[model samples]
Target: MSAQRPPLPPFTEETARQKVQLAEDAWNTRDPQRVALAYTEDSEWRNRDVFLRGRDEIVAFLTDKWRRELGYRLRKELWAWTGDRIAVRFEYEYHDTAGRWFRAYGNENWEFDANGLMRKRYASINDLAITADERRVAR
Candidate 1:
């Protein structure tokens, strides 16, 4: 059996918020392995245009993402939830290795298994270039 991540499904406002916060905290760590653990072993993901299945792809994607998106910082808010699904709106700031900053805004729909590990995630994101002074997320 898979380890249960707490605050399992059928979410309340508070628990849903907790779940979102947990995800945000994990992403902030930029540890792809740790972040991938929150998903089911066979998790499916649609991040922007890229399609990913399972932890290995997730880890590889994140590793390459962080490598290019230096100084990454993110914030996520719980948009809504029902049963085993959650909707989230998020924004994140990161600079390229060339030192140009950008902020990405997106919404994500997530479905979790009974163990509270995300089984599927769909995200739509857009990036906007911004000056360093325009940055909102602190390093």
Candidate 2:
């Protein structure tokens, strides 16, 4: 069995908040392998229009993402949770190769296994261009 990432579900408001924060912190690391550990080996994901299956695919996708979206920083808030599922609302700031900044707003739904490894994730996101001076995410 995999080690549990705790604050395991059937969440209270506080625990759900913690879970969201944990996810935010991990994503901020911009380390694909490290962040992939938060999910199950065969975890499935729908990120925007792309579909991914397994940690290997997750790692590859995130590596490509962070490379394209430079200086990424993110914040996530718990929208709701029940049983082994959680919903989150998040915003992230990043710049493209041309140094044009954008803020991405997204919602994610996650379902976790008994050991607290997320088994499924679905995300819908939209990006708004912003001036670098308008950035809200602190480095």
Candidate with top lDDT is 1
**How far is each candidate from the true structure, as Cα RMSD in Å?**
0.6, 0.8
Clashing pairs in 1: none
- Error (Å) of candidate 2 at residue 59 is 0.3
For model 2, residues 75-133, the per-residue Cα lDDT tens digits are: 89889899899999999999999999999999999999988899999999999999999
Query: What is each predicted model's overall lDDT from 0 to 1?
Result: 0.96, 0.94
C-alpha TM-score for every candidate: 0.98, 0.97
Question: After aligning candidate 1 to the native by TM-score, how far in Å is the CA of 100 from where it should be?
Answer: 0.3
Off by over 4 Å in 1: none
Tens-digit per-residue lDDT, 57-100, candidate 1:
99999999999999999999999999999999999999988899
